[model samples]
Target: MKFIDEAIIQVVAGKGGDGAASFRREKFIPKGGPSGGDGGHGGSIYAIADRNINTLVDYRFARLHRAKKGENGRGSDCYGKGADDIVLRMPVGTVITNAATGEAVADLERHEQKVLLAKGGAGGLGNLHFKSSTNRAPRQFTFGEPGEELELKLELKVLADVGLLGMPNAGKSTLIRAVSAARPKVADYPFTTMHPNLGMVRVDQNRSFVMADIPGLIEGAAEGAGLGHRFLKHLTRTRLLLHIVDMAPLDENIDPVREAKAIVKELGKYDESLYQKPRWLVLNKVDLLPENEREKICKKFIRSLGWKGKSFTISALSGEGCKALTYAIMEHLEQESGIGNEEQIT
Candidate 1:
């Protein structure tokens, strides 16, 4: 299935029914008084978060959504029935906003979460409600109000504990495959991953975390080389970031340190908060270097980049140093969360 994360839609709530005015005229005791029933309320529109749904493709095709109108009131004290409500199921990470006013409406993080998108109008009043001593035979009835309508924009941001950041073909996909069961297409080319891919890495029996891999970010990406928002939006939902640097690029002319710096610069330009998130450096493809020079080369690159944070040297394809990396990530996430390490996310 093609992954679609963005969509726009229009929602219209049902209109309320009109009130009724009547008089009781039976074959018994002359005039009894007003005997009108109230109108039923209109149907409302609601949204629910479904974990089973990972894409917004369905909403892309069906852009307009409307609810049913309520029934009108009858004359012989017969109250009308209210219409059923409409529920829209969307992905768990979906965020809904008012397209016109740029106001945020909802951020669905948990499964089975529901929020109201449009409110239904209230029911109209009946003539029986206006009965009094002076106006016993009154013929007053209030009209129902109109339902609410809105244009909304839905954006899905994938939720993960860790996110991978790097240049094109920096071994992110290979690293994810080594750590988890996700098998994203890998090739000897750039932009192999056009969409985001998620993998679940388990360190122990019950200890696991989700990792996300997005398309490679280039030097001019923030200005327009790529849709800056689309590329970096998924990282905002992550708790940690892994900056994967290709310690051994196939092209001898390419500077790994320069490419790494460019990647971080683009990240900061896209979102400052995302740039401020906890990040660790992973020098990938150490197998390409000689075992004796591995430590020296990795140390030199980290030093030249002025990086003083957590660092690791790993061969993403050979599974070397992958286990230690996953364990460290699991520990960091657990420590930051201040909870048990057994809770799993979908």
Candidate 2:
């Protein structure tokens, strides 16, 4: 299935049915009394979150959703029939907003979650309601009201326990592949992974967590540079972020410290809250360096970058330090959720 995170659509509710007006005509009686009935209510529109759906491509093509109008009222105290309601199924983690006013209408985080999108108009009154002692034979009746129409914007944000970020070819995808079963495209070129890929990292039989790897980020991403912030929104739902650093670059001219700092700056510019998230450093491609100097190189790089947070040295291609990395991440996640190592979450 295609990955579509955004969509725009229009919804129209069904109109209310008209009221019925009639009078009795008897052979023996000289005058007849009023006998009318009220109209039926209109149909409404609702949206539901389904776990089976993972994309918004269906909504991308079908942009308009309209309900059937209610039946008209008739005579002889007969009320009109109401129209059926319309229900739209969307993916979980979808956020609905009013396109015209830019107001957030709903945030669907759980499966089977439902929310009202449009409201139908009320039914009109009949002549029987106006009949009184002074006016016995009433001929007054009201028409049905129109339904509500609106345009909405839907955006989907993937849910994950951890997110990976770095420059292109920085081993973000390789790290995910080494830890989990997600097999995204691995190439030497930039932007090999166009969309977000999720992986389930099982530290043990009873402990596991979901990880997401998004596209790479470059300098000036907030100013519409290099895929922009289009993929950054996916990381908003993650509890932790792993900032991968290329310990050994193919080009000797590329400064890993400067590149790492630029990526962090771009993140801060794009979103302060995301920048402030619990982020750690993962220095990858350590196999490219000598075995004896690996520790020295990593320490010097961290010192040069002035990073105070936790840092790990791992070779994603050779699976070195990957197990320890996964175990540490699982422990951190459990701590955040207020769970202990002896306690099983599942």
Candidate 3:
């Protein structure tokens, strides 16, 4: 299925049924009173979150949704039938916003979460309700009320514990595949991953965390360069970030250190809070380097960059040093008091 993270749609609730204006004319009773019944209420519109869905691709083709209208009232004290409510199922972690007011209406984070988008109109009164002692043979009925309509914007942000950040072809996809069950497209060229992919990385028998592999960031990613800000917003929900750098670059034109610095700068420019998140430096493709020089090269890069936090050297392709990296991530995630705690994190 094609990945679609954003969508726009219009929702309309059902209208109420009209009242009847009639009087009973029985054979035995010559002076019969009004016998019109009340009208039924209209159907409402609702949005529900489904964990099975991962994208907003369904809304891409169908943008408009409307509920059925209530049936009109009939004579002889017959009430109209109420319309059925319309329910729209969306992916978990969907943020709904009102297009006209530019306000966030709801953020569905849990499975089976539901929110009311539009309300149906109330039913109108029938002629029998207006028949009183003074007005016995009255023929007064009211029309049905109109339903509410609005335009909405839906945006999906993947829920994860760790987010992978790197330049194009930095072995992020490979690392995720090696650690988790996710099978993203892999190739020698850049921009092979155009959408975000999520996987569950298990550190131990009972301990595990979700990881998200976002699209590669370019030098001017903060300024909407290359793939732009669509993928950058996905990192906001992550508790930790892993900066993947190509230790042995296939292209002689690319500088690993320079590319790493550019990515950091872009991240700070986009959101300062992103820089404050717990981060780890990962050097990938170490298998391509000479065995004796790998340790020395890794130390030299760390010192040159003036990095004080944790760092790891691994080969994502050969799965060398992947277990240690996963354990380190699990340790870091557990150290933070509320990082993985369900009650505190949301």
Candidate 4:
């Protein structure tokens, strides 16, 4: 299925049914009373978060959505039938916003979460309701209220525990394939990954975490230099980030340290909070270097970049050091979750 992260659509609630106006009459009775009935309420529109859905492609083409109108009331004191509500199932991480007002209406983070989008119109009053002792023969009725309508913007941000960041063809897709069952398109050219791909990395039989791989970022990515502008939002939901750098650049003249710094700068420019997330540098494609020079090169790069945090050297293609990387991630996540649970209890 094609990946669609954003969509714009219009939603309209059903209109209420009209009230009935009639009078009761008999063969011999000279005076009769009003016997009209009230109208039925209109149908509403609701949105639900569905875990099974990962993309917004369903609402990409077809934009307009409307609920059924209520049935009209009949004479002889017969009430109209109310219309059924319409529910739209969206992805778990979908964010709904009001297009006209530019306000966020809802953020669906959990599965089966429901939110009301549009309210149905109220039913109108009948002539019988206006009849009283003073106005016994009153002929008054109110029209049904109109339903709510609005245009909405739907944005999907993938929910994941770990996110991978790197330059194009920096072995991100390759690493995900080696660690998990997710097999994204792999090639020798740049921009191989046009959309975000998610993979579940299971540390044990019962413990696992979700990982997301977005398109690579180039310099000035925050200024819409490349595809990064389209998918930078996906990184907001990740708890940890793995910054993969090419240890041995295919182009010898390009300095790996400068490239790493450029990537970091782009992150901060795109989102400050996102850039502040816990990130570990992973020097990839180490197999291209000799065994004796691996440590020396890694240390040199780290020192030049003044990186104080944790770092790892691995070959994403050969699966060397991949197990250690994944195990470390599992431990970090476990500790974080444990702390969260304790805070909740307190």
Candidate 5:
């Protein structure tokens, strides 16, 4: 199925049924009181989160949703039947917003989460309700209330434990493929990944974490450069970020250090909190480097940046130095489970 992260839809609740206006005519009684019944309530509209869904592609073609109207009231003091509610199933990490107002309505993060999008109209009163001692033989009846209608914007963000960040063809996809079972399209050209791909990285038999590989980002990604903010939002939910740098770039035009700085700058511009997330640098494509010069280059890179955090060197294609990197990430995640910022990552 095509991955659609954003969509616009209109939702309308059902309208209430009209009240009945009737009087009883008996053979024995000359004039009887009003015997009209009240109307039933209309159906409501609800949006629910389901884990089975990962995109908003279903809403792409069908953008309008409406509930069923209530049945009309009947005579002889009999009420009308209420209409059934309409429920819309969406992805677990969907964020619903009001299109006109630009206000967030709901943020569904867990499975089975539900939110009421539109409320049903109330039922109208019958002529019998207005009948009293002073006002006998009344013929008053009220109409049903109108239901609520709204236009909403739905956006989906992938939920992952780890996120891979780097420029195009920086070995991010290769690293994920080596660790997880996800088979993403791989090519030598830039921008091979159009959308974000999710994979499950198993550290051991019982321990595992979700990883997301988003499209490559350029220098001015925060300002809508290259893939822009569309793909960057997917990284907001990650607990750990792996900054993959191509130690051996096929194109001499790319600079590993400058690329890393540019990605960090973009992150800071998009969200200040993202800059504070736990991040580790990984120099990929170590197999391309000469064995004797690998250690020297690693030390020079670290010294040039004056880095203080952890770092690793690995070749994603050949799986060299991958085992150690994965174990280290698992340990770091365990130690800082609840330490840093608890705000929503994306």
Candidate 6:
């Protein structure tokens, strides 16, 4: 299935049926009273969060959603049949907003969570309700209320424990493939990843964390440059960020220190809170360099970039230091359980 994170749709609730205006005329009876039946209630529109769904592709193609209208009332005090509600199943972590009003409608973060998108119109009163001592034999009847119509925007954010951030061809996908079952496209080129790919990194049978590797960033990413913040926004839900730097770039012109600094600047420009997330340095492709020069280059770049957090050297292709990295991430996740921005991602 295609991964669609954003979509726009129009939702319309059902309209109620009109009230009936009738009078009974029985045999051998001089006069008869009003026996109008009330209209049935209209159907409502509801959005339900489903764990089985992971994308908003369904809403992308089907832009309009309408509920069923209520049945009309009948004579002889027979009430109309109520329309069934229309329930729309959406992916968990879907955020719904009113397009015209620019207001948030609901955030379906958990599985089986539901939110009312549009309310059904109420049924009108029948002629019997207006029958009183002074208003006998009345023929008063009311029309049904109109249902609500709204244009909505839906956005889906991936729920993950760790996010990988780096420049293009920084071995983010390779690292994920080495540690998890997700196999994203890998090649000896820049911009190989076009979309975000998620992986389940398992430290053991029971200990694991969800990791997301989004499209790589470049300089001026915040200003709509080179895939821009379209992929960067996915990192907002992650608790930890692994800033991977290509220590051994095949292109000699690309300086590791400068590129790392550019990634940091772009992240800060995109979102300050994302920039402030718990970020650790992961110098990738270490095996490509001589063992003697690995430590020197890592230290020099860390010093030049003024990085104060923990750092590691790993070769995503050779699986070097991947175990330690995954172990450390799992340990950090355990220690930070229920701490920081740890939301329940069902």
The top-ranked prediction according to lDDT is 4
Residue-wise lDDT of candidate 5 within 250-343, one digit each (tens)? 9889677777888888999988887789889999998999999999998888777666788999999999999899888877776678422353
Q: lDDT per prediction?
A: 0.90, 0.89, 0.90, 0.91, 0.88, 0.89
| Candidate 4 vs 5: which has more TM-score | 4
lDDT of 5 at 186: 86
Model 5 CA deviation exceeding 4 Å by range: 338-346
Off by over 4 Å in 6: 338-346
lDDT of 1 by residue, 292-337 (tens): 9999999899999999899999999999999999989988989788
Reference-based lDDT, residue 306, model 4 = 97
lDDT agreement of model 3 with the native: 0.90
lDDT score of residue 303 within candidate 5: 75
Compute each candidate's TM-score over C-alphas: 0.95, 0.94, 0.91, 0.96, 0.94, 0.95
* Residue pairs of candidate 2 with colliding backbone atoms: none
Residue range 116-225, candidate 2, lDDT tens digits: 99887666777878889999988888877888899999999998999999998899999999999999999998888888899999999999999999888888887888
Better of 1 and 3 by TM-score: 1
| Candidate with more favorable, higher lDDT: 2 or 5 | 2
Residue 189 Cα positional deviation in candidate 1, in Å, after optimal superposition? 0.8
RMSD of each: 2.9, 2.2, 3.1, 2.1, 3.8, 3.3
**Cα-based RMSD of candidate 1:** 2.9
Off by over 4 Å in 1: 227-229, 340-346
Give one digit per residue, the lDDT tens place, for model 3 in 1-346.
9999999999999898889888888999887889887777788999999999999999989999998777778889998998899999999889999999999988999999999998887777789999888999888998778788989999998899999999999999999999999999999998899999999999889889999999899998888887736787888899999999999989889878889889999999999998788899999999998999999989998887888988999999999999999998887788674556764556
The 10-residue segment with the lowest total lDDT in model 2: 337-346
- Write one digit per residue (lDDT tens) for candidate 6, span 76-156: 888777788989999887889999998999999899998999998888778988999999998998877788999999988
Clashing pairs in 4: none
